[model samples]
Target chain A: MTYSIIARCPHTGRFGVGTTTFSLACGRRNESLRPNVGISKSQAFYLRRIDPFVLNLLAQGYTPAHIARLLEEDDPDFEYRQFGIIDRENNVFAYTGPRIGQWAGQRVGPYYAAYGNGLAGPETVEGIVAGFMSDPDAPLEERLLRGIEGGRDAGGQRFKGQRRPERSAWLRVVDRLDWPRIDLRVDMHDRTVAELRRIFEEFKRCDAYYQECSRDPRNAKPEEVVMSELSAA
Target chain B: MTFSVIARCPRSGRFGIGSASYTMAIGAHCDGAVRPNVGVTVTQSAPLLRNNRLALNLLAQGFTPQQALRVLAENDAHYDYRQIAIVDREGAAVAHTGTHVRQACGQRVGGGFVAVGSMLANDKVLDALVAGFESQSRADLEDRLLNALEAGRDAGGLKGSKGPLPERSVALLVWGKHDYSDIDLRVDLQDGAIAALRRMYVDYKPTAEYYEERARHPRNAIPAMEFADMLKNKQKAMS
Candidate 1:
């Protein structure tokens, strides 16, 4: 039902997360952030408290493995939930519920990993994970696209299992390390995974145009108008 | 708890959405992109992923915005708590407001785009938002969303407040064929009651600096900040 990828660009020193689910758009429902500490989580499939609590634990100097232990220790019913973490130290951690589907599995990367269940097929989840790891040296955008393609090619939840056509979302975040961070999401849409891939491939360019929009005088005050409007009053 | 913006690029026929909510950053909870149709969505608050994903699917299949939204909303789980607005590839618009929303919840349907919000005050504030968008016609959807938010503030905002309603945030998104190169803004915070909302709106306005360098997604993609150069340049020229 879900597939997610969290990563760090050791070369760019940037990080990102990309995901899509057969159940719902996880990006629209989850949130996480840390200042060179670690990325946290509060996803819809799991309790919202997990997001901040994990980050808080890391902020308090808990390693990724320790934080995972803490969450598991506190929840007692850890198998019923799912979680993944990647700290600045690149220590990765994850947990999958016992009730997950056959397609569900977790992938551990040097900086991140992918976990999913209720997916279209076994190969489907594997495809997403393989795509991410296939090019460990690729840009975050390309890597994410490959992962999503992996899901789609392996027959992502499209018309399979015959569920209520659940929804899913994508999220990508990084440290803003001089280079800008990639933060994108989609809420409640069909073919969302495909769309997520397409968006990322193009954002690199469009983001530039938006950069120029801010400097245009039209965005300024009346007299300060950088460019005069041709439309008459 | 959430604030966001959606817009289309006349030059490329691309549509986008971006938002920010209380403690929930814009990129994380309410944002996505569809390349084939050149569309993006900024879903916030409860973040209705099913409906949002369904709507996009319908759009890909050539359904009009209105029909797509209707079909998607018919079976939504938390339909009563969701608010949505969409801009089709052709610039047609559609919007929906769930039943159990707050007072100020509403949407302003424009010619090719729409602005929607939830968990607010009375109808006047909503109407004022439309007025604000209209007044800022020269501005792109991002600014129009901001204008609508300003209108929301002008109409006493969240409540008929003597001061500001400090419980909100804002996000702005713009999508296009340029793909990863779109301009979006996702301001995650503010301090006062309206703290979150204001901080989101103002912080992203710098929009330019993000362009000279590379802007990432989930950090700026959900909100479309990377392509800042396009909006400022194109919209400014058109204006």
Candidate 2:
């Protein structure tokens, strides 16, 4: 009934967790971050309480597996929830509920993990992760958008029930600063993953394009720094 | 439907913007400010990048908040449907909410006090803010802002919003006038916003002052040293 994509980008000392779920109002419910502490993404079978749970675990200095095991054991339908975590240690952990719909899966990498449910198939998430990891030359956001597109192309959340299911997702990652940066979401859409790419391309150019409009000192009054929207590569 | 009014408090170099949105993400979307020359608020609409950019430009041209809003409205296609608030380098403020904007309107009560809100919220939401800002004798930007937010929420916020209605909220970009303490906080999102930004101002809070001194003059990092001492003192004092 829903599709969500979430990942962590650890740049320098910054860590951010960005995610988007096809379920209406997913952004408001499924995403959470704790500055340099760690990133926790609990969706599909979301457990809002997991936010504090993850924080407690990290505070206790528990490993990713320990927390994962706790979450899994605690939840009657452990296998149904989609959980991904990346701590200050760069360790990655992910869980897929046993009762999750078909074509759901997850994959982990050195600094991030790509998890989705009701997707086209297991290969979608796997292919996205691999493509993103292989595109070593691209900037962080580019790699993430590439990974999302790869999944969407591989038959993302199935098109059933409705004439066409609204394919919506969000992408977020922090670049080593522990600052929750790069937040973007499309509440609803029917376009293929490619169209989403074009939108993200604009986002990647100026992540804060909406707010960056006033950076120009020329944009500001005379005394302010002449800031301009200098798109990042 | 959401109604809101916004404005900037130009304190010479540092600037601050104040806005209240009927929606939960108002703090994230409707407010944006910078130190030195400009403060802006984009309310009751999708983030308008075009008007936002123009507002900054107009402010730089020495237009007061009123002038900037008039210019942006005149050239905007959705002018009637968009509401905005601005303050330039001089404490001057101006605001506009599209005429089509209903049950959603706002007005400034006193200098540096702008209240705008709508979205199932009682009109008192904004009125409370106006009263809080105008009534409170507080001079600190942060305190005033918190008071305004507190007043608005108590007047019965979304009551049953997407979430349990925020007991605690955040103000992302706050530039204090007395001291150049500018706060740029991104509560939640997408990516690089890679703009290398300055976290603190050179003259305001202790942190900024310390950093400033460390970069300039050979004087002992007075602020830095004092900060360390303060932390230690605070710890000891608590102990």
lDDT of 2 at A74: 73
The candidates score, on chain A by TM-score, as follows 0.79, 0.75
TM-score of every model? 0.48, 0.48
Which one wins on DockQ?
Answer: 1
> Which runs of model 2 end up more than 4 angstroms from their true locations?
A1-20, A29-31, A159-166, A175-179, A192-196, A204-233, B1-106, B109-239
Candidate 2 C-alpha lDDT tens digits along A128-186: 77656667566666666677666655655653322224334555555533223554444
> For candidate 2, what is the recovered fraction of reference interface contacts?
0.00
Supply the TM-score for candidate 1. Answer: 0.48
DockQ (CA atoms), all models:
0.03, 0.02
Any runs in candidate 1 off by more than 4 Å, and if so which? A23-25, A41-45, A101-103, A158-160, A163-166, A177-180, A215-233, B1-127, B130-239
Could you give the fnat of all candidates in order?
0.03, 0.00
Point to the candidate with the largest lDDT: 1
**CAPRI band for model 2:** incorrect
lDDT of each structure? 0.55, 0.50
